[model samples]
Target: MSVDKLDMQSPDLVYQNIEKLAESFPNCVTESDTGKAIDFDLLRQELSHAVVEGNKERYRLEWPGKKEAIVTANLPTTKTLRPLLKESVDFDNTENIYIEGDNLEVLKLLQESYLGKIKMIYIDPPYNTGKDFVYKDNFAKDTQEELFESGQKDEYNQRLIVNPETSGRYHSNWLNMMYPRLKLARNLLSANGIVVISIDEKEVHNLRKLCDEIYGEKNFAGEIIWKNSSKNDQDYISTQHEYLVCYVKDKSINKGNWIEKKEGLDEIYKAFDSFKKKHGEDWEAIHQEALAWYKQFSESNPIFSSKHYSWLDEKGVYFPDNISGPNHGQYVYDVIHPITKEVCKAPSSGWRYPESTLKQRIKEKLVHFGKDHSTVPNNKTYLKNTEFQSLTSIRYKDGRVASKNLAKLFGENLFTNPKDPDLLCELFKSFELKENDIILDFFSGSGTTAEAVMKLNFETDSICRFILVQLPEDLNETLRTASGGAKATITRSIQYLKKFNKPTTIAELGKQRIKLCSANYTKKNKPTIGFRVYRLDDSNMQNVHYKPQEYAQANLDLFSDNVKSDRTADDLLAQVMLAWGLPLSLKIERLEITGKEVFRVAQNSLYACFDKGLDETFAKEIAKDKPLRVVFRDNGFKDDTAKVNVKQLLKQLSPETEMKVI
Candidate 1:
């Protein structure tokens, strides 16, 4: 299809049309006096019976004999008694990090302390290729399974399922997986920060819409096209460009400009010799060549003179108007040259100083005249008077190639892709970097951001710290064949430091090993002192054994490659919550008093901790506490239990609390 036709064929527009159509259809039931649909009066009547007398306002009615009960529990009064061990890996002393695990969990763990503090975030998430390990979506609450099996159709409907291409909800599945994560990421960006998502064309459109919704459409920045590959083998044509969608938290608050300084005029003078050597020193030709070369150099360097005019009277080539405005109201008249003895007319405007300053100019012998005594005189301004060059976006061929040269210095493809440290260094130069400015990059990748910041600090003698996050995904096979696998990526990155000749050792990198740190809330009553490790769950076990050794040996064949038997899901979840800053003293109780066994947590407020079977009676008891927060395990709830009524129970008891399932 032509580009114009493709531009008009947007999936988003089509989706909007479908949504409008759906909304226009009317309900098949009658309307109530409140103008709301009245199809659920029977269910409401049943729910009314669940209320406990005076607490009727706090309870929600579910069904006739299946009425749920409501009660209020006191919040936990326990206090934190001990200091927590620092779980965070300290990379402040270095510029690298290699984390091993799921990025989603890591991101959640960082939300508490790092919220709205990250300066830059770069993510190369799985592209959702059918073969890629897509995160399994878990939306069903713990009670769902129970309700389903109890001859209840609604509860069975909430079972967690993998999204398949033929499901007709392919895009919806991807969107659901990404929505919460992106929302969390937006909260972690600094007000003046930006996030860059690297994506292929397949999901670029979806990513853009997702980012617009989370980061605000007004904060949308332009997309940057990166040439990721030289060869492409597709059904139709080669696709070589990947997009880097940039979004700022608040565009108005972020004031960023290209970091480049103009080249000094002296460099232009030095270049004259090279130009003469290339294109012989024919005065006019040499001047032309030099001027052309300087123009290109100045465009990038921002230091070369814009106007190349020599002093009118043999004062030499210099930029016009070097002087500033008159200091006082006194009008400084132009001085007469000592040699020409004529009133020297300042370039167009007049001398920078008033007439009184003319005496100083003559005394300093700073005035000059034209070859003809009668012609208008001029001032002598040497080329040495050049200060720092101005800033500009124009890039010179030389500067543009510096990054490539730097990349080559570290070895061929040593790093999959490395950014120009100079680019970041230049950025630092433009800002007033305080000694304590903490820079962060969750997508640390090859650690280029750290290296760039280090280089800037070295040059300016400023002390700045950096936080880098990089998931240790196994290196691609291509990378392994070329430079060995995981070890090579790390080795090449650390070795690049030799370019600066600083005392960086492989041992130092190892010593400064990055540890997985969960958010503060990942812990339980007593926070996990060490890293809370986790592995994906699998169900291939041949048999269950109580002993660790027996389980490992007998079930070896049944264990999936990524499965873990050392820790339970609850153990890992607790650790993750502790690291995420969840407070201790939160109550946890397993109750068998409802339709399905349920776990209840009550402290300052109640939280349903039902990660397993949720009994109706247990849920009723949980509702009694008037929980302020509740989360359920996707596979815990029964098939026969009513899922909709679970929501109704919460609404009747504690209307202001939040309820979510994982």
Candidate 2:
């Protein structure tokens, strides 16, 4: 068989949708001049029992660029991610990924490999505050219009456009930018995955409506009102809170409540363990010592709030709770005190649990009583049993904590308003992630989510991974337009980047933050602490590789090969892995097989050799191990006969292996 050629482009979403429709409603799908497409009239008829009409007014979100936004989400991108070895901390083994690119294109490129793979997605997108910059997607801009507008934008490639209030389509522009990115993000989420978006009051209403439509109103999980700051700057009312809007991919699949251990519970447990070690089974002495220890903390402290849980037993630290029912006349029963061997004084309301349960608790030493029979028996609520609590709708965290921590890490205030990693850690823990589960943050500003994931893994001894994507927004250009404190902050950031000989961009700053976090980590038993850095750029292939027919036959000889002149074999391998639906984290090993350099990926899963002079001898040598898939450079073969013979040799030796060329 003729060798198959790699597409070297992101998966075509429109075609995938058509195939999905065909599977569900075969009669509604038909072949068109362009390709397989859904017959709209037939599809409408299939959904309704009556005759379908056209152009009905429905309650839906509408904007000037809604159609264009839909088109943008469906459009395939030819952009590919090029791995940067120098920037990466641990390129070979780390499962964590850090990507610098326009997140829209990055999301499109990740569609196939990470489809339904990510467990959580947290993004702090631009809140459409009029001053913030939003991405100007190239597909939405006409060629002539783009040329005209290029001069109006900044010198940083004109990829970002400031969305000021003076713009005519202010809300429309923000919605257009967000819609396509959110649409693409939804595809990466697993069936039970959830996405949390941070927004302020500036665009929260519009954001809620947009997410309600995209994630389905039924899957709209509750929102968190984070009282992070006490801002008196607002004239009307002091807006002190921001929102974390959460939505599940499929509500039906996401069962159970999101629960997390209460803050300071770990410290309380540690203290209790120490008390037990010192006092042994002396319950009264442990309780007295614990109460004395708790007295040192203020009432505002979370640990101090748990002071009532000082009483100890073999079951662990506990507090006495009233066993009385709501009313004054329910479930009254006789209970004899163990020490006095006499009937104990019953509660006025009667027991909370039934008589049989109360008896079992007394027998199991879970019921606490007074020294004499005069006092009512109480229920023992163990601190260990009540460690986890349901996530609250409102949370209080000082926003400056994150900024201060980041400043200390860099020894300068390099970023503006970084999110709190501790807060993100608590939020992620509510989901109870498994080992290797991915947490993706497309708008990874300051890399707080990366820090949070690493800290979570280290503390819990779990191996969850993170994928962070941030645009390389130039800080030098930003400093030019910035004013007051913002300008000073940017100047400091530029100096910091210069100190490290790094680029003056937001992506670089984020990378440094991650590196600092890795360096500062003191734990010897690290849990996937580093990340592999990849940057989105033009594909490794030349124009002729994608559209050879566009070039004249006479000029074909001038091209040496389909691959780009400056691209390396490693770049080609990355694109090939992405095109083949393999994750970028797969282990790669370089080997020399009979003189030709070959890449052995994930053991015997895939093998690729981009070097020239391929022949039957090399093919026979590689085919011995029998990789599931193999790729070779098209022009690398010695001759047509040599290429044909290699294919035949592989077929005879490893019948199951599929051979392709790029």
Candidate 3:
């Protein structure tokens, strides 16, 4: 016997698999002096003909920056989300979040707390249309200098690059931006989670291969063709349809719950109700009359031919299905006619069930018969059997509808090529999500996903939450300052902001749109209608930048306070939300306890005070509130006497409270 050890080199799944095999079949694994590497020759003898060789090359999708993408995924970020108190609508009582930051960095930050927590993720990354902006991790020196001069991008510390048509590695550039983000996103998905991505024909093929490699090929959910709008001005051929590629975390566990639901088509149901009233409970007769009217239902009708529901019963309208199976097998049998005391003829193939099964269905009235025993029976599948239709791969709708929706919300065309909220609602509702679940959208351009989730929740009364991450790509200042221009789209929104004297940015547009949409589309049944805003920036805590050689006692005074000068109580509270993984929208109540304003988060989840005028009375009053967690600025104490006694007093007053200082 010899000792086996793991390799110190970076992970090798091959060796790990061998080790797992050795556990169940120890006699086959022989150790060598070099390491725990598997003795394949010996193992081969144990398995005999069942042994497989791995020396041959295997097929895999690879690109120029694939290795770098993997490296990028493993790297961590040192950024924190700072709360923009004035920007948030309901700073105290909302669970929805709108984050302003680069999504890749944001994903890295969320990987820890939100791992395996998201129910679904839908992203519409740039479609690489030669003009679209794509992120390149390469921190170009020239871009840095330009950013340092302008001061807009210097704080972000990354450049947004465009992989224009002239670039030789056009496809490779997109793969780089998406590869790492997808890798991180897969970690955030719960065991039964999924990711839906929207892409055009240009990069959809490559995007599928990328997702296949990241979220295993077996978990590949079907791709949906969004047949949105038509193009009569096509130079060669009309490529109006785009694609939505879906992938699950692990197919074996996901169980395709989404396969059972669809968006609510209210108009058709309303029309059905009208017909149901005109005629009586004679379901078939009323449906026939409705179908006749639907046949002449104007060709210019905006919706799909929802009137195709041909079969009807006491329950609802449905399409009749075939009841035959393959040649005389287990399902082959004779079915007795419902009225006549005679057997009904079966198809040459056979009935789709055994005699006993046919008898049970007949007893349950699921079997629909023709006029007599000579006629074959049909299957009556009720429409209500599954309220949602099986999602068809192809979808027909107008893509321009999204722009029109945004135009209405913004009172002008404030964005370029935004996604339709209706389409996003359909994509998300496909998951059949019930109860409260979190959705993450990293590429949250124009806040379309947020608006979609909001509308879906309002309509269904389902509390599905969302986390939208968008990069604060600086607005072209010219557009913001423009008085008039044919190309200026956000002129009206800018003027609206000017009245309020708001700081102008791209994130401002998304936040304002969501606010307007929330106000306009708010449902009375819903409790909350706003989102908490957080910006990616340096931490509120200031570091001293230790210099080892400086042996001066006076320098210690400079390090007395660790909190940044410009930071506020709200700023610290926001960082606490990030560190604790609490929803920033959690309700916060500010109460002045013994002259010190203490902020209580969501009914005493935590109590914090950054006030400098703290005393022993502050602790005693806060303890009376009996919060679960308490935090304070170290310098807030009047002296060391109060600082030392505060924790002890809190222990006795609210013994369960965990106390800490910044």
Cα lDDT tens digits, model 2, 1-662, are 89999999999999888889989999876544343568798799899999898667588886667888899988877778899998997788888899998899899888877989999999999988887788777666665687466333433344677777756567777888999999999999999999999999988888889999999999998899988886789788999999999999999999738997766667767887899999888877887888877665425453346436467777877778888988778788899988899999998888788899888888899999877899887899887788888887877788999999998998978777789998988888888876888999999988999999887876776778899999898886577557788788889999988987988889999998898897555377654367899999877778844322212123322444778899998998888778777888888898999998899999988999989999988998999999998888878899989989999999999999988777
Tens-digit lDDT track of model 1 for 157-253:
2122333454334555555555655666776777887676766787788888777767888887667665544565777888766666777888789
Task: Give the clashing residue pairs of candidate 2, or none.
Answer: none
Winner by TM-score between candidate 3 and candidate 1: 3
The local distance difference test score of each candidate is 0.47, 0.83, 0.74
Q: Give candidates' CA RMSD values in order.
A: 19.5, 12.4, 12.9
TM-score of each: 0.43, 0.82, 0.74
Model 3 Cα lDDT, one tens digit per residue, 126-197: 898876667776432476575554444635554576567656467778888999999999999999998999
Predict model 3's lDDT versus the native: 0.74
Residues forming the 10-long window of minimal summed lDDT in candidate 1: 67-76
The regions of model 2 sitting more than 4 angstroms off are: 1-57, 140-158, 267-317, 326-328, 334-345, 353-365, 370-375, 520-528, 545-560
Error of 2 at 445 (Å): 1.5
Q: Residue 464's C-alpha lDDT in candidate 1?
A: 57
Q: By the lDDT metric, which is better: model 1 or model 2?
A: 2
Q: Which one wins on lDDT?
A: 2
TM-score of 1: 0.43
Backbone clashes, candidate 3: 1
